[model samples]
Target: MNKKLLAGLISALLAHAAHAFDPFQIKDIRVEGIQRTEAGTVFSYLPVKVGDTMNDEKAAAAIKALFATGFFKDVRLEIDGQILVVVLEERPAIASLEFTGLKAFKPEDLKKSLRDVGLAESRIFDRAVVERAEQELKRQYLAQGHYAVQVTTTITPLERNRVGVNFSVNEGDIAKIKQINIIGAGAMSEADLLDLMVLRTSGWLTWYTKNDQYSKQKLSGDLETLRSHYLDRGYLEFNIDSTQVSISPDKQDIYITINLTEGERYTVSSVKLAGQMLLPEEELTKLVQVVPGEVFSREKMADTTKAISERLGNEGYAFANVNAAPELNKEKRQVAFTVFIDPGRRVYVRRINVSGNTRSRDEVIRREMRQVEGAWYDGEKINKSRTRVDRLGYFDEVTVETPAVAGATDQVDMEVKVKEKPTGNIMLGAGFSSAEKFTLSGSVQQQNLFGSGKHIGVQVSTSKSNQVYSLSHTDPYFTVDGVSQGFDIYTRKTDTSTLAVGSFGSDSAGGGVRWGLPIAEDDYLNVGLSIDRTTLKTDANSPLRYRNYVTTFGARSNTLLTTLGWQKDARDSLLVTTKGSLRRAVLEVSLPGSTATYVRATYQHQHFFPLDRRLTLAVNGEVGVASSYGNKDLPFFKNFYAGGIGSVRGFDSGSLGPRDTALNEAIGGDKRLIGNAELLFPVPGMGRDNSMRLSVFMDAGNVWGYDSKFSLGSLRYSGGVALAWNSPMGPLKFSYANPFNKKAEDKVQRLQFQMGSVF
Candidate 1:
């Protein structure tokens, strides 16, 4: 018999069994029709057991108990010679699940969603549950603006009462916003009001931001932005009355309308403080942003309150309350501001709890903390601690939360959670150029080794002209207080015999130890010492200057090197920085050596200014000089070279400077000067994305030999456009330049591109 019909018959028989059932004692219980489920489960759920009197009430109660288990599709009871019989039809279990045409989301994510709803693989399937899953998938699509999405399900029965469930989804086109209407704009123009919202009708740049897509969350955020816009412009009583969204018949187009009221613009009549001031009243009053006869701004008011609160927080009162409420007058269109202050008891941090560091050691994150345990809580320090952890680059996400202790009202616990990412990078890349054919390079770097916050890197490079191998390690905190120490050992060979740079080769092996001390926030002082063994090889086509130098100084030399440097970086961001300045100065010198004794000093400064939201102007300047301290001459290999990405683009790398005496080949120089300016702009399809940017830059620079004089005629000039992207593959750069003022002898590389991870 079919399970449904058999179950219905049993229910009917139970209803009629009351009239026919005589009081009788049940002897035994037997369950049937359970394939995978144990019979003991049915007996446990049964309210009546052996030796119990059989009656209509008991039979009905037993049936109700079994059905509630959700393990059975049907339950039946029968009496055969006083031996109770229980028959169960268990629901089919889901053997496997599959999805087709699910483009909006990944398969694993969808499976997880199904698992959350208890309709996944290895779980019993129910018709009602399947319908619910379908609705969920449809709603997910609609939230992303795919209103016409269609979802259908299919179940294929298998042996052993198992079934394969499949969900087929058709994620149709995203509904485009066709129209947006703003009504009830009094104090502000309708155009000005509409400009404040992110949502818009289909426009040229809609593909990037998708602002035309209809979403509930987007609408809510846009409405909030609109409210802030009016409130910041002195509209004290701005209110959004209603919002209506309509969809077309085909569901491929949507329309949004918002009605809002913008009250009269109010000017500030007076500003006063109404509460106790822990600090001087005059000092706190200065933080108040409003002044008499000025237009009232809620943004400024909130900022004033936040500033007051933070000042108290910095002073160890973490729980301070600062409020700035306004009194509005309609008749005069004037607003009165009152600042209230309540300094709560000083709180201390009980403990800082670090969690979610599955692979990272606790100390790796704790070292970044500035807030001290068992000390008075300072809000500034706590916030700084979070920023420091986030800047570590080991974690994909970092979060810090402060929650009050259960029993300690004066103490709070801070929880720091971090999600670790793949910190080790191994890169193998090859590039081909007309000058250096088939160049290959690779490196292995671990910034967070075993979660100890130490750095280790190994690098190797080979090309037709240059070869390098190096190993290095760094401890960011050799001792506390932000001191760093590191060491590097390297062997390099470079043959500058390529077309424009003269014919010479050098092999050098060296080792160095460096120490860095933090002088201030974002400023560091570095000192280092090194010893190098260098041998020069010259060819028949070598520059005349190099040949003379080899003859005079011999072919091999041992030199002692010392370096002192200071650098300060205050950029707002490492990538696509729009503001801030960077300054660096370095002095590297060779102490009296068998082959060389010279001093080289270089200074560089870079600054950027934001012209507006869409543009920034950056300028860079550098100057360097190298000269022998005594009778020794500056090493030929130590001469400063220019005409490259860092100096002058559009010219060949290391191909500009004073020429050889006879061959006219670039022999580099002992003096260097360069200046660069760039106008940064947003990429075409990338709006407000800081990971990538485009810039138009101009570069003018040159290197001068020790005997050569500094002159404007020797400077190389180039102007072009460049693109920089922090892509998934790696950091990529592409630039096109034109050297308009180049001399006939200058080697120009007009188009340049670099790819692959170079770390």
Candidate 2:
């Protein structure tokens, strides 16, 4: 009876399980909340189709797939008797994105950067994506030293299931470099090590170049430089084990510590040459800047090798190799150098090719090249050509390469490549000189004229006492043999005083031409001749002064002057000059068409002294003398005047000596002297590439009549400080001057500045 009852119960359970629930078969599909996403897209993700059996597993998967598209906030799957329903809450579309309080980056640019990360206007919005973008934005700011940056994001829903997102950013103060310290420098002082670093603590000039701001890339470069400085100076075992950068709790201050190991320094004991010299051994030895008695320096050795190679190439050796091997003496702490040299084949330039100049004419570059085809290769010429191209201000970069000519023995091809940059500029300026206060000047200049390697300029200036208009042109390569030519035409009207109680005004127009003849590879002799016609108006308020002045005066005059001068500039840079020039001119002056002659001679000397690695001192002096010969009368405008911006800055224009009662200004005399000295220093917290400088200058000079006594006590003294900016537009300068020894009568000049000044 128990077995029969159990069998009946099992049969009943089997019958219930078999008829429990047939799988629901889908007959139709429907979707809800289809705003941005189409209903078809929702249906495509569904696992159930018409006539297909539906189960709890299939329904859950379909819902998950739809949600994973990131286009729906909520997804629900439902089933009827034979139909499956896909319900989704589509994400709202973005109408637009707005940003506020952004300083470092533009709003439009920020939006564009976000577009790549699946964020843009009219796109479905997701909270997760927005949060990721906000993090990325903050990271970019922090990388640029904005450690305290704040970012906020807000989303507002609109009608039609659209949304608007706004990002409000606060770009706080930039993190500045507070301190830099060197640790574990066993033998070097902390101050000395810090001096070797390019990154430094904040000080003045922080606002200009912003070098005080911290950057990982800049720090890496500075560390490399520091390492090289030590290693090159005989610290062979020097090592920078680690560098630590720490930020303050407030994220405002930054501290850096560099750990270094400096080894002992070594000196050179002996020097020997190991290779055959195309030139004499003595000649090659003279080329090396390093000596046996000096400390062993890798940089000096490298420079010595380069100099030897350059000397060989200059002597028609196209290829040369120079290597230095050091023999160490442990006991003496000294090293001996054995320099090896290899002079390669004496090749000639078979062909010359120029490229990368899209606008410049081929002839323009070819004419400036010192090395010629079919000639023996010259390294000096090649280097000079490169420098000439660089000085043209037309190219961003210029390089020359020599490739061996296939199948041609002792022949190579020269290729010149150049990258062009903008060289034309327009300038409008207003400035004040003691001589011409309240002056206005404007100019338009083109250094590369029509891409033909010529310079053309037009300038106009007006002042209370002077007016000038001029046009000038220069041909860098006037002839095939490297001669230069310059031409200028100018018209001027001036009212100026003379020492002898007379005021002279003149209207003159003239043109002058100059020809440059190459005296040496780096020197030139220039000759110039000019002719001008002048109408002079003179007035005398003092009878005694007029008596001496009227005796040598002329109403109108025509003059012809011929001048010869020479210049040699072989310095490593133009910023430092050590050169001199002697000029002699013979002038013929007359009334409109009269015959008169005068002779003048002038000499100038300039010298540069390097005080240290960071300081340079310059001194310049000039003297001019004039004498009358074969002319009964001297031209009124021919007299000399001094005591202005170019002369003594403290004194008024032409006010260094006695003034003419008849004229309101100082007069030009027959003899003059001028001298200036300057000390240049780098401003702290500014990079050397775009550096700022502070200068203290002293100027002294005087003008006197030919017969008057020349005395040093008569010289006026003025001292002042100046600021210099090496800017893209050129060197911009501002100076504060105290004229006449800083006396109360000598007030300070508040603002004296200029742009695009050559000196």
Candidate 3:
């Protein structure tokens, strides 16, 4: 006779077996009722082995072990003539997975999500796991504001003990915020308060911004902004009590309500400093920004503490602590603040370790460091070191951390990590016009040549009107004391016969040596010298002034050029600057011995101001003036031109100046003026991505002949919107402009674009 025991009946049946049967040794073990799983897999999980005494306890343990594996839905143990039988009813394996009516998410993305949850093809299927996967998919849709989404699962049995799983999803309309209410905003208007938030009710630009969509995370951030607004305006006891979000029955609209209390505004009664004043009392007192008569501002208080701490850090107190304790007078509606300073132990850097530089040499980064090893830790020096390294353009990211050495209270080690980017690039540029037909230019440059922090470039351009080839090399650190030197060799050929300018041709060859000396942390003094020989070619179509100049100076002329320049750059980034100012002034003078002696001075100033977290206001202006010296005439070809991409938009390139009346073409002038104001912001739907930006700008400028006086009324004006993208290929820029003043003789190009170039 065969005896059997089920897993569920283990406790009850084991009692019967213990009383009626005696213990017997197992002769052999066998597994049954498993089609896909190997029998050896089942045998390995069994607690009992052949030739072991099998009792009621061992039988119950074996059945429980097999059931816990999740591969089987039912398990049983049987005995027949001293042999043990282990039977398992294996769960169905998933054969095929499919999805239908899915629009919001890609099929592969959903499959990957299922795989992450351990519910994929070829895995044993359980109803509970499938239900979890279904709920997960619904949650994902809800996060995207698809509140009305529907998901249905269908399981169909297939051959060979397998099953097919299909998830049919219908993503409905996205829910949008319909209204927002503030309960206790007494001091501020509702409109004004709402403007400070990123999320809002539906509006014209909501489709692109997606601000109308409700998100738990976005709501939380908005709440914080609301709290800060009142706190910054001297509402010392401001608080948000509660928030409520509700949706319509159709799930297509959402409403939000916030209740807050704005307490009485307080003024600063007095401010004082206490505890361990390391610096001069008067000097530290000047850093306090909170005035007794002014309203108490959290922003100013925070600024005061940070400034004091940084100042102390510069004095080797790397871990200095500064805190502001405010005493409130509710009766008088005033507050008094005492800033407490704690100067920690003086610390020196024990070691500096560099990492993440896979290609650049250690010295390439080390030389840029302003903080030296074994020196007292100076916060200012460390900040400068990080900024200098980041400005190298060899790395995408640079980070520095100073952690206290193990078991050492006054010692720390600095870790400088860098993420290197591609330093070599091959850039190609092309331009098209009616006169030139087509022009192509290319450059091959390595900014960090051989990991030595040097730059080398080969540039070539070809066209019907102009051709240029140049080679340049620069060593940023020619001398250890931060002096830079560079060499350039170039030849240029220009033919203006097919262009808007006066018809003429010229061939020139020259080379230059330049040097840069660091005068300050952000200032540089530049000096350069060059010699060039130019041969002029003129025909009947050339302007009278041009032909006369060529005849007076002969067909060929030689000149010695000297340039002196001063530059101060405080921009936070070279690629995408949000704040800071850059000023550059250069003077070029030709010696009296040259065929043409002239002095040209040009100055440019660019400043950026951050309007908010994601917006910047940039103002730029440039001026250039040239005059003859030693009774020599200024070179005709060296005249400045305006109305171009780098000057004024909505006009032809280099087409603005005094016109050649005979040829009805422009003749460039000896003076130039350009000004631009741009409001820069991130592209909509791109959250905090620095790789791309959009700007609305106003441009104004003009060029004047030597005899003409500078007049504000003569300047051109334009308004436009531009897009800048730092794509994988290169930096790309596009602009569309409308000229406010377009003369009949002026040539206008409303649309302009460039690649592999900076704007």
Q: lDDT per prediction?
A: 0.84, 0.72, 0.88
What does candidate 2 score on TM? 0.75
Distance from true location, Cα of 475 in model 2, Å: 3.9
lDDT of 2 by residue, 1-759 (tens): 111111112223445535323456667776766766777776676666677776545555566677678888777555444555565677888899999998899888888878878789988888877988898889789887898999999988899889899999989888888998887776667876676566777767666666677888888988887777776677766788998998888888888888888777788888888888879888888877767777777777888999999998987787898998888887787888899999988988888899999988988888778888989989999888888877778899899999889997688898999998887978786755444556677888999899998999999988777889999998978887878899999999876542222355678888889888887866678878777767666545433343354455545556777777776655555542323222222333222333446666666676667675567786778777666666453443566666545666655555555455434344456677889898877765555542467778988887776568677877667788877766655556667666665333222343466555321
Q: How close is candidate 1 to the true structure, as a TM-score?
A: 0.87
lDDT of each residue in 323-373, candidate 3, tens digit only: 999999999999999999998898999998999999999998999898889
Better candidate by TM-score, 1 or 2: 1
Residue 672, candidate 1: C-alpha displacement in angstroms: 2.7
Which of 1 and 3 is ahead in lDDT? 3
TM-score of each: 0.87, 0.75, 0.83
Best by TM-score: 1
Best by lDDT: 3
lDDT, model 2: 0.72
Model 1 over residues 610-703: C-alpha lDDT tens digits? Answer: 9965689999999999998777778788888887567788988888988875786888889999999999987753535556789999999999
